[model samples]
Target chain A: MAMSDLYREHILDHYENPRHHGTLADADFSHEESNPLCGDHVRIDVKLSEDKTRIADAAFSGEGCIISQAATSMLLESVMGWRIDDVEQLDPQHVLSLIGVPLTANRVKCALLGLKVLKTGIKLWKLQQMQHSA
Target chain B: MHTQREFFDVHAVRRDFPILQQRVNGKPLVFLDSAASSQKPLPVLEAMERVYREAYANVHRGVYALSEAATAAYDEARAKIARFIGAPAVENIVFTRNATEALNLLAYAYARAFLREGDEILLTELEHHANFVPWMVLARERNVTLKFIPLTPEGLLDLDAFERLLTERTRIVTFAHVSNVLGTITDPAPIIARAHAAGAIVIVDGSQSVPHMPVNVQAMDCDFLVFSGHKMLGPTGIGVLYGKRALLEAMPPFLTGGDMISYVGFDDVRWNDVPLKFEAGTPAFVEAIGLGAAVDYLSALGMDAVRAHEAQLTAYALERLSEVSGVRIYGPQDPQRRGGVIAFTVNRIHPHDLASLLDQHGIAIRAGHHCAQPLHQRLGVNATARASFYIYTEPSEIDALAEGIEHAKRALRIS
Candidate 1:
């Protein structure tokens, strides 16, 4: 495939001007992950609503390839008002569809890095919540 | 010098490598990842095939004629490699799976046996993971201390810092003869002199250097030198570990099984002699023969000419790359101090993105930490795109790489 096919206009836009591209200071939980193969890193900070049932806001910060940073930007923008449980149920295929590009096996990791960090963060936060309640 | 240059024609050399004569992504393939692993020449490939077809048997085990022939070929390969590196004796060269396995062998057989608590092992920031992680693992298990020789702002090893890091407690000093990422060549003579004065034995990781330049372990006086075959026009699954005669004789075997033992006993085992003691089981005899053929190929070309060719190519690459705006090249600006590897980043483009863009143009370059994460962290960059050269590389390939980078910049919308 040509470079243009992968780095489309929308992907470039998200990469150049990422949405929610910084940490939320009063975030309920945060998690950071790195793709060891390429040294690409992504950290996700999420803030829950007052009722703690839905994600009020989510921001991601990291340095990496265009697909990773842009995918994270696009992912955060799509899931801003998503229910916390629904976000947990988000699968890897959903992330690939969100990327909207055919990726080689190696690059699939780059595109999914954001979702991996976000899902892992939510899982850890849930674990902490359960501990506090107990 | 001009006559030598004329004698070693790169176009003639390029013809020997069959893989270079192909198209990728509808463009002529421009391979720039030789530092990762080089393309094999016809001689090496033919040697391997001839061995499989004519003389195929388990080496050193069979008493039959075919086995003897295979054994003779394997031993001849060892002798060729020994001569290639200026090793004193063929007995000093021990074969392993690759450079990584060679380094691990030393860590297990030497460091685990000799290193004590609080003993310091000095290493450089320029080491690839193959040289670094083994020592790190040893330190954790043996309660040893690991110290690093810092790098200068120009990415060269800080010799002053190296001298300061040397101490009486320093038991081992190991560093790469050349940095895989920066392509900076470290002169081992002075490092070895000082390390010996401090009572530390020096190990040189020659994975990058040996394939590019003339190396003499005897002249350098290093205790151990490790390099892989695949990076030097040989097939995979074969590497060399050259040690001083006494050192190899003294160190216990790292891996033990059938061929390595002189006699196997349930109560006690008598190990075979030095080189054989280290090599166990059915070795990669055919691959070793291929490596022997590779050594012959390089020897025929003359390493001095190979070095001269790469130096000229590197100088030209640096100049061409510099003309492109916003291109930041790593390593020493002077090509004399570096090998033919150029690592760089263009504008704000991520290396992976740039690599993918270049792939569309059929230009292959490495994009990552290059297995030197500590050095990448020191440079304050996650990754860089690297283009490395070898015997068959042409000047037009460099021009193609530079043009490809410009094309990549435009495609990524980077001004």
Candidate 2:
């Protein structure tokens, strides 16, 4: 039972003190998702650029397992300056690689919770944009 | 059959479950999740296999030799289960898919048939979704109101609030005999007496209580009680709903099909007797036979001895788990009021993480809300890790759980 295979030092560091782990007071777009079986919740709030093409700032707030929370913090760090389209292309495998561990089938949902929130937030942001134009 | 002396012996009991001998994650398997679903003993498995191999046929409709043999086997199982639970007669026991289906049957046939608008249904905060949801549906459809007995901070039922909630309008009161998550063994005698005095019928979800304790439906004086076979070392897809025969006789059939009918006309029909009227189709006779074997195994061990074994194990687990810094236990701390199940949360370690870590040590435990979301909400925690004991569980497993928690804290870099 090599615990290091799952909880490496960097993963623990991020889990102990998550980065950008707070709610944006006035976010342009936000989304929340939860793993009902494990009760792992993840919410992402993003401030889009004026041109609406790039993410100007992103923050997250939720309580979950170390893998979920740390992966969320890492995910928040990776998408700060990315184009909305590239962020949308992020998939479960990409999140797996970001966490750098082989999660069992059950725990895959925990590692991917953050990415789900981000993708959902992007869709909501686009929806809000459409409503604003109208 | 296990010898009476060997019955209380944990080592001998462990040998009965073949699954316990295997290794998981390079460590000896430590099964601590019996409360979720118990592992089958050799006898239970052999009994089901015997039925399928030798006496396989649909029950009641067949008149041939094999069919009669099958029917006899199935009927005998019902009688055994009835005697095991101290029901008045075999006619009072109805077989359903599982305890969930059993609860749904009572809700539809009994509660839906009898209750009316402005009536009230009282439930507790600790009900599993199976027990809680059906009544909620009944309440909505019949224009009735549903009230809850608030949970005390100690994770026991608030009996004071329960008294206040019971009114003349209360037609039914349903709750768990033992909470699946809290492991709190609620004494239902008071509740049953009070509900009966208030003209309300009582339904006990004995899914948790029936497996670990000696249950006598007549002595309890409840109108109905339900439990699943899978949780008691039998096969899945089989459960028992024990009701007073008169109540079962009065309620309309929940499901209508080939087997449950006594006679039929083009537009009108005559249903079967007490239990069969509720059992609609070809019931799981094979699984029911398996459940009978499970009952035999438990009876041979003696329920009083089983209860004592779990009490000893639970006390040891509580004492051992408390030694782990920052581990907060749920339910009554006193072993007298709790069963073998222990639900706890370690500081800075989510239950999911802790469960996974324990898995690495070949220790199986349950994490999350355990299908009691309302209870979790009331407890103000998203989830908690649970380690439950069975006859096969030993004190050494609790030590493994404690070590697993320490290892998890270290891996997570928590103090």
Candidate 3:
């Protein structure tokens, strides 16, 4: 318990010195995802590519416990260059495995915060596409 | 622990709650959320067990041996609750599913009997939804106004706001004896006095107080008081609502069925006595007995000791959590006037993360809106982490919580 495999130094480094923690409100699409249970909220913006094949640029703004904010920050970094298919197929295990196994049953939601926001953004993008087609 | 300190011994009291023996993740159960619902002691469980084993029959309807025994036990349980809360008589004690249901009963009976257009129901900003929603729905139905007593800067009830809100139009003054979130104990005497002077009936939601502190319906002099058995270490689906005799007699029954009517023939009926007039169906006999046992058990220890123990534990928890940098505690920061409930949010870390980290160490706490959505909104947070304590809680558990929180901070990489 003393040496947590779940909370690695890298996670701490990313959490303490967060990258791209602000927002891009001028971006094409912005969505907010919040878990009311634990007071975790993330506002995400995406400037989608004209082709819609890959995410062009992404940035996030949020305040939560470390798991939520860091996971969100890392997730934004992880998905920026990847295609929609790659992002959709991207397993949360990859994110969790990297962080180590310090999570208990209830804490899984915090660790999974990034994945929820990323998925929600993708869903909102698809909805917007349908709206334009109509 | 000064109040009733000589009546009970803490070491002897620890052995009563069986849940303490259980191990989770190879550690003893460090339960810190009794406000949610307390674990049952052996006495309560056995009371229910003994009823099922020896006397298992429906009450008030049957005349056989088992039926008579069951009816007697049920009535005896009501009498016990009446004695426990210092109710004027057993007839004033009406059993409902829980405190929520007891409050609902008031709404149903009052809506039918007293409510009308332009009436107002006065409530506080710091109320659990159970206490909030019933009155809200009632206000909607009666086309009445639901006025809230503004909270003080420190999360206590703004007594001036409460006094100012009262008018001839105010039908009821509803408030919690002790806030479930803040644990701030309100001296309900003056509030009840003001409400009565304004011709407004008073309803005290005693779910939080009856379990931890001594309550006398006569002394409080409120129109009604409601509390749940489960929150006080009894079985669920059982609660007590004590109304003044005149008030109980005047209000219409909330439900209609057999046993509540004294005479029924050809579409004509006469309702039964005071308490039975409200309890319409087959009552929770076993649970009622268990609640009686729970009342006995808590009384044996004494409310004064329980309050003192919780005060010490709450102070310890507040002191420890405050020591951690970047931790923002909620509710009244002063621990002396507060009960054992403490809610906090760690900077750069989510409450879910803190809860999960603590769970691994077998320390249990509550996180989220905690059914007190308004308080969360007032604090300008959507959610927070809460840890509540009871008689069995130990100082070591607080240390464990602190240790677990530190681990969460490091793991999340928050300062």
Candidate 4:
């Protein structure tokens, strides 16, 4: 893999001075994901519409190495205002590919840390929506 | 050091390790993950092969020729290991799957015996999870407090904090003889002295140190020292836990099973002696024999020479990897007290990314927390990439690793 591909300038910028890195007060969905092996952690808070159909806002909070923090920040920017279905729609490989380089199998989980929180939040949203409909 | 003996060629040593000859990204493999598990040597391989091909049978229970031969081989292996660590008898040696299991054995048998509510266990922040987790569980289960000796800024264990932490409540002291991540060699003698004065038993995690240097359990004065065969050019599924004879004789048998029983009756069955009491069911006889052969191989090369060769490679790699612009090494700058392990972060590249690009150049390294989460947390990074050396590792391999890291950084342009 090219070093350039792994360290996109945008990724490093986000890691150095992260964007939207705090709790969203109006958040309806928040999920904490941790990579136990590496100790990477992220608490992703999404401000969802009451109907659970849309993401109104997104923010992240946690401590980790540069890539992990960068990835979470990029995720917040990428997912805001996107439909809940978009997050639920992502495959593991697509999430990995977004990092721009292929990953070794063990490190693949590190790349998926943010995607896991997004999926967990989506699952919670769907469950709440089912309960509301019932 | 003896330099008169015929020097072993790097290519010849590479031939002994079949994995080194294999292709990676269309290049000959450059393995740097020996800290995880060293590649097996021919003698170690042949010893296991002979055990299986010539004499394969259950140990201790069987009375026939094959069983007796296998049992004798296994017992002989124990004797060699006891001598290897300067222990007085084979009774002090209990076999386990790996260093982790050996540590858990002590946790179940010894730690459970004395630890109770309000007591404290002293451990160093440099412990691998294998050493740290077992004691943590004991602390939580018995309501015992677990404390750590904080690390210096250079990543060595802080001797001052260690001295201050010793008190009447402390029952046990455990720490790594060598940090698997930091590559820092720790001197446990003073801590052992203090713990002994406080009436605390000490456990030394020798998983890394035993492979790189000579380990004399008697000289170290540790109650228990655990090491893995896989990290020493021997097979997996076999390891050694050297406990003091009196200590082993006193502790309860952890796992109760067939081989561990003295005899069985409808109402009562007594446990066997020290090593047998702890060894339950069929042991890894082949692996044990292989480990004995590994001891012989390392002995033939001499541990002092192995230590010297590894130290040279480490210093060279550290110097070259640091040459990369914006690269940061987390451990000590001095090579004198450190082992061959080197952990670092590149300009702005993730360790996983560095590992992948290194793979393209047939260079292999370990990435992530390396199973020492607390150390990583203390260092304020989630993960770091590591390169560790062994007897078979060469200066050329270190150069390849440096070139690969530089290429990886330049390709990504993280700076």
Candidate 5:
């Protein structure tokens, strides 16, 4: 019943001043998604390494609840130096734990919207690369 | 205003709703979401149970004792609802799944059949999706133009704009009796008269209004009125689509199957009477009986008093919520011009976050676009947190809501 359980200090800090929050012009992969229920929108633009295996830089641009905006900010920080394979393996549970809150059944979607956009963007990027190499 | 406080025993009324007597998240359950779906009273719950246990049978076909009793109960339920809305006759009431289905029926059967090409269907910017989408679909299919009566900056419908929109090409005029998000109680008298003068049929979406106030279709003089049962303390899966007897008679059947036709042949068919023709297949008999009980419950309490109670609560909520910093409320400032629904936003606190924090204290409120995306677009807010009230809601709950907003601000670390 603690209010702090859902809106912790770290979440609000990241939400107030998000890290790496803007669209990328030199982006290799980009995707935008919105939660149909609450209309919380998030877009993730990722730049890849020259070798095309790791995420060199990541940025996000959108407006939403603290769980979503802060989640995207924290997600960008975590995935910047990650391999594409590791980013692809990021699941909903990992995103929820990163949010550091006990989200209810309904608010889980708000917390994971950024991760969903990133995973989808990476998947689409991998598909395009497969077609090019073929 | 002080005399209105004695209208009802809110504590006694709260006891009648058994679902409200429970605890959630280690706190007493504070239900502020009555506009979504009201909790049922004991009489309403027992009414449906009595039907299933005692008079369980298919209506209209069997001549046995059980079937006869079931048929009588179902018929009486229809009559009670017909009386509840001040319909001219029972034949005017057509049962549907919910308000959405009833509106779909009107759009498909009435508008599609009567209106011709290049006609206009005038709607407002404050409509819920149920009232807005069906007409849009009908307009697209029938090659009719669609126009909107825009809203003022304060969220009232622009009556001047509405008059200008009511040209000879306007074939139908429809709007919500009370906006679900903004809670604006629009006066339909002028609009109804103007539409009728232009020879256009007027349909009123009373899903929000009928549950909170006394509505007289004859007084409103609209051609058709639509509302749902679940939002008004009845069970789900039952609603009423009330039209004038003549209009329903002229309209063709929207759905076709068993119980809707008098006789059938491979080459030709004979449809049943006005209301039954629109109602296809087996109806929700138990739910209808439950709705009848809901009408009885509301009638015993009196609709005027029910409305007064909500007005008092809304005024209190508006006053109390204003005390909380950064809480911006939508809709008219006058309590007389609105319902118990309040859609609001807190500065730097997303509705989802506020709603989540409130749930910890066992306060339930809706946080979303509320099925009115276009209205939200017009209001320029992605989402809002809505707290709606009914008879059981009290001024104490309003205090809790304000305190909850403060708690949310503290939790979010906002100064």
Candidate 6:
């Protein structure tokens, strides 16, 4: 594939001007993950609605390749107002589609790093809640 | 003074490497990733093929002619490697899978056998993971302390800091001869001398230096030296760990099963001699033979000429790469103090992105930490793209790399 295809205009735009590219001070849950191979890092913070059933807002911060940083920006933008349940159900294919390009095996990790951080944080937060209620 | 151009013709030498003739992405291949692994020359490849075709058999076993031939070739390879590195004897060279495995062997057999709690292992920030991780594991297991010799702002190891770090508790001093990322060449002679005075055994990771320059283990007086075959125009699956005679004899075997044992009884077994004591199972005899041929090729070219050629290329590369805007080259600016490897970052472009863009032009480089994360952490950068040179590398490839960086900058809309 051409280099341009991988770094498309939208991808470059998201990289240059990332959306939701900061942390929320009162985030309900936050988690960070890194690709050890390339040292690409992504930390995701989520704020739930008052009822605590929907993602009212989300933000991501990290340093990495264009695909990683851009994909994280796009991911955070799309998951705004998403139900907590639906966000939990978010799969890798959805993230790949969001990327809108075929990624090599190495790059798939970069493109999906945000989703991993988001899902892992929610899962850990849910476990904490269960422990507290019990 | 003889010039490299007068003595060594890079174009003629390039013909020895078959892979260099290929076209990738519709452009001539500009392989600048020799620091990762070098391309095999024809002599090395032919030697390996000839061995498999003519004398294919398990070594040190059968009494048949084929086995004997295989054993002879393998033994000769060890001798050639021993001579290549100025080792005292052939018994000092132990074959392992690669440089990583060789380091692990030393960690398990030497450090685990000798070190005690609170014993210090002085390493540098410039080590590759192969040199770093094994010792780190040993520190965890043996309750040892790992101290690092810091790097100067220019990326050279601070010898004064090294002197201060060496204490009575320092049991081992291990470091890379050349930094894979920064291209800094640490002179082993003084370090070895000081480490010896401090009662620390020195292990030199010569993976990057051995291929690009002349390295004499005996002259350096390092306790152990480790290097891989693939990085020196040889086949993979072969590496060498050259240790002092007494040390190799003192250390226990790291891996044990076959060949390494002198005899096996129902309840007891006796270990073999020093070199074979370390080499277990069916070894990579063919690869070793190929490595022998690689040594022959390099010797024929003369290592002095090889070093001169790379020095010239490194100087030219540093000059050309500096001309490009937003390019920040790492390591010593002077090529005399470093290897042929050049690691740099361009503007705000991520190394992976830069590598991908360069790949489109058929220019291969290493991106990311290059397995030197601690050094990168010290540099305060996540990653840098690296371009390394070899005997066959040309000045035009460096020109291509400089041009390719411009193309990458333009594509990413970086002004």
Q: Tell me the deviation in Å of residue B254 in model 3.
A: 3.3
Model 4 per-residue lDDT tens digits across residues B290-379? 999999988887888788778777777778878778778988878878899999988667687678778878888988899998888799
| lDDT computed for candidate 1 | 0.92
Best-matching candidate per DockQ: 5
Candidate 3: docking tier: acceptable
Error of 4 at B363 (Å): 1.0
User: How do the residues A1-134 of candidate 2 rate in per-residue lDDT, one tens digit apiece?
Assistant: 37778888788888888998898987888899999888999988898888878989989998989889999998888778889989998777877888888899888889989999899889877887789899
TM-score of chain A of each: 0.97, 0.93, 0.87, 0.84, 0.95, 0.97
B1-415 per-residue lDDT for model 1 (tens digits): 0122443877888899889999988999999999999999999999999989999988998899999999999999999999999998899999999999999999999999889999999999988999999999999998999999999999899999998889999999999998999999999999999999999999999999999999999899999999999999999999999999888888999988878999877798999998999998889989999999999999999999889989988888899899989899999999999998999998888999999999889999999999999999899899999999998887888889888989988988877
Looking at candidate 1 chain B, the ten consecutive residues that score lowest on lDDT are B1-10
In candidate 6, which residue ranges exceed 4 Å CA deviation?
Answer: B1-6
Q: In model 5, what are the clashing residue pairs, if there are any?
A: none
Error of 6 at A82 (Å): 2.9
Report the Cα lDDT for residue B136, model 6: 91
Pairs of residues at least 3 apart in sequence or in different chains that clash in candidate 1: none
Alpha-carbon deviation at B165 in model 2, angstroms:
0.9
Q: Which runs of model 1 end up more than 4 angstroms from their true locations? A: A49-53, A83-86, B1-7
TM-score of each: 0.96, 0.96, 0.86, 0.90, 0.96, 0.97
The iRMS of the candidates, in order, is: 0.8, 1.3, 3.4, 3.4, 1.1, 1.0
What is the C-alpha local distance difference test score of each model? Answer: 0.92, 0.90, 0.83, 0.84, 0.91, 0.92
Predicted candidate 6 versus true structure: per-residue lDDT over B1-415, tens digit per residue: 1233734767788899889999988899999999999999999989999998999999999999999999999999999999999998899999998999999999999999999999999999989999999999999988999999999999899999999999999999999999999899899999999999989999999999888788999899999999999999998999999999999999999999999999999999999998999999999999999999999999988898988888888888888989999999999998899999999999999998898889889999989999999899899899999999998888788889999999999999887
For model 4, what is the error of residue B22's alpha carbon versus the real structure, in angstroms, after optimal superposition?
A: 2.2
DockQ of each: 0.80, 0.78, 0.45, 0.42, 0.81, 0.78
Per-residue lDDT of B1-415 in model 3, one digit per residue for the tens?
1222223565667788777888877777889889999989888989899889999888876789998998888889899899999997899899999999989999889654788899889988888888999888887777989999988878899998887899999989999998888787788899999999999999999999999988898998999999999999999999888999998898888889977889999989999998889888898889999999999998888888888778878877888889888888877877777878888888866676577667767888888878888877888887788899887777778888888888777766555
Residue B23 in model 2: lDDT? 96
